[model samples]
Every structure is written in C-alpha cells, then in structure tokens.
Target: MEWGPTGAAAVPADYAVVVDVLSFTTTLSVALERGIEVFPFRWRDARAAEHAMRHGATLAVGRFEAMSRGDARHVSLSPASLSEVEGIQRLVLPSPNGSTIAFALADSGAQVVGACLRNAGAVARWLAPRVADGASVVVVPAGERWHDDTLRPAVEDLWGAGAVLDALLDALGGEDEVTSPEARMAVAAWRAARLPDDLLRCAGGVELTDVGFVADVEIAAQHDVSEVVPVLVGESFRDATEVQPAAPKLRRVDG
Candidate 1:
C-alpha cells in the first residue's frame, strides 16, 4: 500500500500502518501527543462539519483558510499549528491521501494506527504486542497525488513507511518474523536514504517549501521525537497509551 487508495483493496492484514509524512500522520502524532482525538475524513465537505459536531470536535478549515483568517485559534492540518493548539478534545483531519486511507481501513475492520517519522519507534513499540502475537501488518505509504489525481510516489512517505517498518523489524528482533515483501522493501529503502536532510530536498518536501510550509517539513522530519501512537478507535484516533487493549492477541479478520 504505497499509493492512492489501493490499501483499501490490499490483502487483509491484522494491522494497518498508515504513513503520510508531509503532514497528516505527523499532525496526528502531534495532536495525539497533546491529548486530542483525531477523526479521519476523506473530504472537507459539509459532512465534515456534521461529523465534527457529532464528535464535539473542530473541523479543520485547512492551512490556507486558517492563514487567511489571521487567527491562531483555528486548528488545521499544519503540524506546527496543531502542536500549538491547546485544550481541544477532538479534531476532524481531512486529507486526500492519509485520511482517506485510514477511513477505508477502518471501514474494512482493520486495526489502524497512524505513523510518521516523528513517532515511528513509539508506534512500533505500541504495536509490538499485536505483531508478536503472529498478526500481520500492512504498511501503507499514503503518497501524494498528481495533477490527474494519480498516485505520485512521494519520497517522504516512502521514508516514513520505511522508518516504521524498520522500527517494527528492530522490535521483532529482525526480519525473520516479517514475511511481507513490501515491509522488507520499506525497511531497505529507509536504511539506504539520507533521512531528515534528504527528506527536505525531496519532491514533496520541495513543493511544500515552495508553498511556505517549510515548518511542516521540519516538523515531519523530526525522527523518534514523540511517544504518542494514534490508534483509530471507533471513528476517532486517540493516543494508544490512553486506550486499553481490546483483547489479548485479538487479530481482526477481513470484512
């Protein structure tokens, strides 16, 4: 699951590792760190407001809209701004890539966890109990979209996924227990790349920088800085530390 919405149709795995390094997942990690619950939405449509209202959460108006308002009171998808927000209990994070993938995975009955470079190690540690129980995992690098809405493989996302996979392998004591080919490739790619500095010069990173989102890139590139793992429970993502385990070795089957 390295592109588009393919993870929705990917082979059923016990857990889903959704990575969107540009912002979504990174923002998720930050917000969850601050005790905010995130609801992944596919669109910022009228339904977003309804969903937010239902959850007593704030609907993100996006970075551009929030910037134009000249107010720091609103929460958007920006990781920096999200880190600054305080006292918010819940949020609606809508994205074409990460959120969409997460929504699909949740609908398909998978135990979904949001991951990024910032919280890769923590996420892997949180997921260790499940993985060690012989449960498989799908590492989805939710790539950016092209002009035609096709999946454009973003190097940042690949690195994010690789970081998480690598962390998982390390936790599992090596790749002997990991049989997924995609997982292995992700680990290999992350090991061969230049990391934070290289991530800044990647295509997605450059585009974000051009749009005055350099801070977001820097925030996303902070490796292993967070201990929060955003695990999707019901319709919202809450810090895994705050949530109790559903069942011991309870592996979910494909719906």
Candidate 2:
C-alpha cells in the first residue's frame, strides 16, 4: 500500500488498485454500473473540454461547480450526483489524485483496477485468481492535495485502500504470499474502521458534507455495494466481467 504519485512511482507492481473514495474511483464505479465508459483525465486540465468534445463525451466538473451552474446536466466527481445521469455513452472524468495515478500506472504496463469502498470486494474477487497465480499487486491510496500542491494523506483514501487490501487478504487467506508491512498496516486500519459513522466524521467526509455534498459521503460509505470492477482499457474503463469470454481484457485522455 502506498500514497499518492510519488509512492506509486516507487512501487510498480503487476496490478494496481487505485483508490480515491470521495471521488474518482467511486464515481467511476457508479458510472460503470450505468454502462458509461469513463475516461480519466487530469483534474482542472483545460484540454479536458477539447478532449470531451473531440470524442463526443461528457466532461465532468466539480460537484459545487456543477451545482452552482444551475443547469440540469448531471455528472461530477461526486458518485451520488451521477445517480440520475442518463444517455451518456462516455464521460471524461478528471481528478488530481486517482486519475493521475491511474494514467501513470497504465503507462508503466501495470494492469490498473479502480477500487473504492463501493467496489473493494468486487476488485478483490477479480484480483484473487491472478494474485494466487503469483501476480504482484499494489493498493494506492490517492491522497488529497494541500493548498500548496502537496499530498494531504486523507484518511478517506486510506480507509478505501485499506478496505481493498483487507478484502484481498481475506480472499487470499492462508496463502504465504509476501505482504508488505504497509499493506498489513492498511489492512489493520480497515479492521479498526467504524464504517459509515467513522467515515462521516473523517476529514474528507466532513469536507464534502460541509460543501452540501453529504449525500456523496453517505454513498461512499456503502461498502461493497457495487460489483462492477472497473478495469482501465485503452483510453477508458470498462467492466472486464461484462466483456465476452473471447474478447480481450481490460487510459489516456484521448477517445
């Protein structure tokens, strides 16, 4: 288990579980469940609009920004906001944490899997077979950014990463696979977490709720409620399980 891009760069495993619980990965899971192919982009990238237009995909903005726009168009980093979105075949979802790490990992030849509290178990289930076959895996907790553009190490992401690690360990129980101390620490954090209640009080959760996105916080706390395992394929994330048995498996900003 590691935090942010720097840590991610230091550990390039065969499989990477990208976690950004308050947004990104969680939102990706929700969109995947709706059949919307998601393209991860850098947060606040001015080129995102151009990329979206070029590919005829919707570009997501911040939750508060979208809400203040007073338009009916739905979609944002907030998972709950996408609940009512429809007819969007594709989306250009941007984020500084999860999306950045995902694209970086993809370029490094690592199989990228988007994981959040919502779909941790599903991701673990998807990874079990491959891991048992001796594949390496790393759970990356994409921490929040500070005002100075530094890593904030949000507890929300830690919990999300922990959730995935714990599930993976459970799925691989009794295996003598070498698990790192950091991975063990994350699993311990998950074991000690108090669920929705604790999540609600965490810094990340408070930040979202204070901005009137309490629903998003509540949605993120719904652990393992999703079965969609988002696998980054080509320039988008699609459900590998939904792919035909014969088809190739499962992200640049390009279409």
Candidate 3:
C-alpha cells in the first residue's frame, strides 16, 4: 500500500514494509549503518525537540524546502553529515515524506523493514525465504503528495516499491512471470526491462542529486550492500540476517 505523509495510520497486516526512497528512508538506512538508532515520528504530530525532551531521545532533522527549524542540539542528516552518527540513537526524525510513513506502519502485525533503492537487493534476499513460505508481504512506499499538478514526485515511491517487487520475483525464480496485479503494474511502471536507469530517474534520485548526496543515492540504489536486514525490535531496530518462512498463508478477502 502507498501512503502519504498525513496517512500515517496503522493498518492490519502480517508485515509492513516502509520505503522513503528519496532521502528519509535512505537517511534512516544510513544512520543505522552508522550505528545510530532511528525513532520514527508522525509528521503532523511530530515536535522533534519536544518529543526528545519528553523521551530523552536525540533529535535528527533533515533540511527540506530550504528551511531549517527546531533546536540546534539535533543532528541534521544533510548530505554533508550523513556519516557522522553511525552508532547513535536518533530520537526524533522529520523527513520529507518517508519517516512519517514508517511510523504509520509501526503497528502492522508483520515485521517492518525500512527500504530504499540502496537496500532493495538485500531486502529481496531477506524476504526470499518468507515469500517462499507464502507470507503476505505489503510494501508501503512513503510517497509525497505534490500540491502542484504539473509535477509530482511522490510516484517515485511506487517505482521503488515496484523495483522491490521485481527483485522478490527474481529471487523466487519468477522474473518472467506476473505474480499478481500489483506486481504487474509495478513491473510496467519500472519497465522492469531497464531497471537500473529506471531507478536512477526516480524522484528520490533527483532530490538526492540536488542535495549533493548522489553517492549516498548511488549507495542506496545498489542491490544489497550488507546482509544485515534491519528489523524493528521493541523500540528500535536490529539487524536480522536470517530469513524465516511465514507462519502460514492466511486466506482473506480483500474487498
């Protein structure tokens, strides 16, 4: 399912996968790689400094729309400082769109994994065993809602999610087969034929380049950099490298 910033409501599912391809999700992945613990906050209700004070969590805010708000005590995930907080706890996060969606799916029954173009390949390998067991996988792309009708970058998440779906299919040895309607659409949108270029042209990719995080963008665009798959454990996420089969496929009606 694709959810916008304001639509951070919890949904029922076996697993909720969040993707904020452009920077937020990519930032989260980078932070975790650096050893920083990332805590998600709802965009509408998120007051980073206040929340940090209340929960004693460190604040890590991103600069967006050319504005920098909140306390200076927090760390900013600008392209320049992406590698600084490798192993710290990032209490409050205000990302362009990805962070909020991660929070929205926090309560989803299935495990939550932060996704970006960078980790798509690793994520697919991580989920290969699960899909083989018939687990219901829901890929949630934390997309944008553009006010201007002329250009909307939110659809980039859809393309990112499609790339993930394609990766999963390939892992399952069904690269040439359409597993479902959503899979087919994602494949079509990405033109799954020329995946690498398609991924580079995504909205998130453009934003990363503008911010001079093109290297970071390229890193996130890689299939699987680490075998470590980040999964939410209690309040924070830990690296999960083992892939377990799903409990059992549940038959449900999607009306």
lDDT top scorer:
2
Report the lDDT tens digits of candidate 1 across residue range 1-255. 445478545667677889999889999998888888899999999998999999899998788888798676687989988878777888999999999999988866668889999999998997777788877777888998889988888878888888888888788888783456776777788888785788789988888789898899889989999999888888989988788646433455553
Q: List the candidates' TM-scores in order.
A: 0.93, 0.92, 0.73
Total clashing pairs in model 2: 0
How many clashing pairs per prediction, in order? 0, 0, 10
Lowest lDDT 10-mer window, candidate 3? 65-74
lDDT of 2 by residue, 1-255 (tens): 889998888886777889999888989999999999999888656799987887899999888788988664657888887877877889999899899888778777778889999999999998888887767887999999999999999888888888887888889883354878888888788878998998889999888888799999898899999999998887788997875322222211122
- Quantify all predictions' global Cα lDDT against the true fold: 0.84, 0.85, 0.60
Candidate 1 — which residues are off by over 4 angstroms? 248-255
Best by TM-score, which number?
1
In model 3, the runs with Cα more than 4 Å from the true position are: 1-12, 44-46, 64-74, 148-155, 175-178, 191-216, 241-255
lDDT of 3 by residue, 135-172 (tens): 65677777665666222446566666776777888898
